[model samples]
Target: MRFRIAAALLTTAAIGLAGCSTGAQASDPNGPLRVAVSPQPHGEILEFVDEELAERAGLDLEIETFSDYNRPNEALTQGELEANYYQHQPFLDEYRTEKGGEFAWVQPVHLEPLAVYSKEHRSLQDLPQGAKVTLSNDPANRLRGLKLLADNGVLRLKPEVSESARVEEAVAENPKNLELSTLSPDQLPRTVEEADAAIVNGNYALKANLKNPVAIESAEGSPYVNGLVTTPQLKDDPRVVKLAELLRSPEVAEFIRQNYTKETVVPAA
Candidate 1:
């Protein structure tokens, strides 16, 4: 859900701002821009921008962290935040399509590969028949997990199954007869010790210190690069533009390379 990061930890402004702003012009144009983010790479990346780059660039930022995937966009839509950074275009598309809103994806900042992690097994081949496998509960991520399994030859999806296919319609073959289950994305890492395998998002994997994975989604030609998203009016805001530039800057890219492995967090090309 939506929660404030302690001011000391985030180095941000106080979280209790008045609500009711409808768009970019609704809030003080010169005030610190409130941007919502996930705690791992998203928040960390913005923290770099806030502490290192913002002042010099003449931008002020207030960072809000969220645990639930739905909260950032919800807050943004309600004007509690000016913008957000934590989702790919596909996830954003699904959210907009289902929930009905007008939001713009600014630009891709990094790619966090979906991965298969397990504490009970060393490799996918080691998973025994009827092994418990858990995937994140969201539709886009669930389909993504299914694709990751299919890529590894553990399961076979239907020939005609598209990207939007549901979990049931996509699974055409299950050679291991694996017992698949769904859990919240945040819960996947905690289940690693109990389940035979879990297909986890790269951000959550890193947060839980699950750096090494048996298999990971390839970043090359991937459309799932997480980026900045804002309302239509805020898309052209000077502060938003400056922040986007900083997010894709050489320094930010270097920070990503030095701090995160290519497997976990890859700077967008």
Candidate 2:
């Protein structure tokens, strides 16, 4: 009878363990979803989402902030991260083409307009001839800078030059004859003192504490907006869908508006 009681006790303990295991599985189907992001406002933005919504959705969002553009994608592709929120579609396409990786943009999250910042000039019109202008040297960003320049009449591109056109494609008719220099996006903010003007990405500009960039890209209907991206396998996953929805939530939208005012970091509808 004591052996039978011992067996019953063992069975009860096994059932309790199974019940706890089942409860944990129900709470976190796949456990926490790890995300990689660029430092500052992007990372900060994620903090808001992670605290306010992700936790409630059973998503344990672990954010690893990167200082440069290259590592986030590398991390995501290597399966070290489940998703990333630091690049535009054009940039992602170029990265995939060059790196031979398999990843896809899950959804458009925000538009961080590329802007021209200067200590000497209040507007692009104030930029004089021979002004030293710094533009991002990466293929994708070079094109974006060129388009912004074209929009401001600083340079002209062929009529057919679409959003994808790069500096080499410019047909410079009456080009401000401005001296253009190329640098990494991260270097643009530091070089602004020497440069009469610099076309800097929104995040870098914000990092350097430069307020109200002289000229911002008009991203009203532009496709060059930034997005949330993930591995191809996770594209259809319900967790990804939920995360995307949270990104577009009212709370995230308000955070973006308050944090990136005049920088135009619009949340995706």
Candidate 3:
């Protein structure tokens, strides 16, 4: 396994401290641990830890924020970052397979339900035939979004298509003949403005302040909860472990509920 789960957090924290004890960077008292995160909630959550919790835990935290979801895992795999906090396991699994890099994830901290927001359409049924609908360009999210549409009776996948099916396999049935277009997670908001509606990652939806999406991923047992992803080498680094702990702390949970509305983001179970 690229990242082995720790038997207990105490044991992991001890391992992390051991790696961080030496002046690895030689300048700071606590060696700097570089982590990549998404802008809205992940970055906000990290900022809080970087500001409020890390110093007390004796961890020097540095943040790299990404608008696009592509760079974090690539950075981690290439040794540019120690860990990242913006992606779910399904995405990590698909990315590792597609991009040919090894990656692993820790326990999830939060679920950012993918949602569909519209500028012109009042409801999915109301959207005219051939209405352009933007979906995630990434296969995992695209399939999930298409599945949401499928569950709602808007479209269906071919019988042979698996749960993680991509766009090519998704036209099993389109009664309304709605035109589905693909867009990267970052661009979904702008695409939604131009198109009839777009299934959007929750962070981007919140960043764009898009209201009343025609569809949203069900929060119950959603596979899209974001978590810490790290290279196998740094999986036990104390600073990384500390950051993961802080991410799941009560304070962070309260902060998330307070800052981002409960209706959108929820702490992972």
Q: How large is the C-alpha RMSD of every model relative to the true structure?
A: 4.0, 12.2, 8.7
Using lDDT as the measure, what is the rank order of every candidate, best first? 1, 3, 2
The C-alpha TM-scores of every prediction are 0.89, 0.83, 0.83
lDDT by residue (148-179, candidate 3, tens digit) is 88887887777656545668676688988888
lDDT of 1 by residue, 145-173 (tens): 99889998888998866656667778999
Query: Tens-digit lDDT track for model 2 on 1-269?
Result: 00111324433443454335422111233656667677656777878888777867766666666665876786666565678888888888888878877887887877777889888889988888878888998878887788788888877777766444555566456456788888989899988899999998877888888776889988778777777898878777777788888887888888888877657466654
lDDT of 3: 0.75
- Which segments of candidate 2 are over 4 A away from where they belong? 1-29, 161-169
How many pairs of residues in model 2 come into backbone collision? 0
Task: Output the lDDT of residue 29, model 3.
Answer: 23
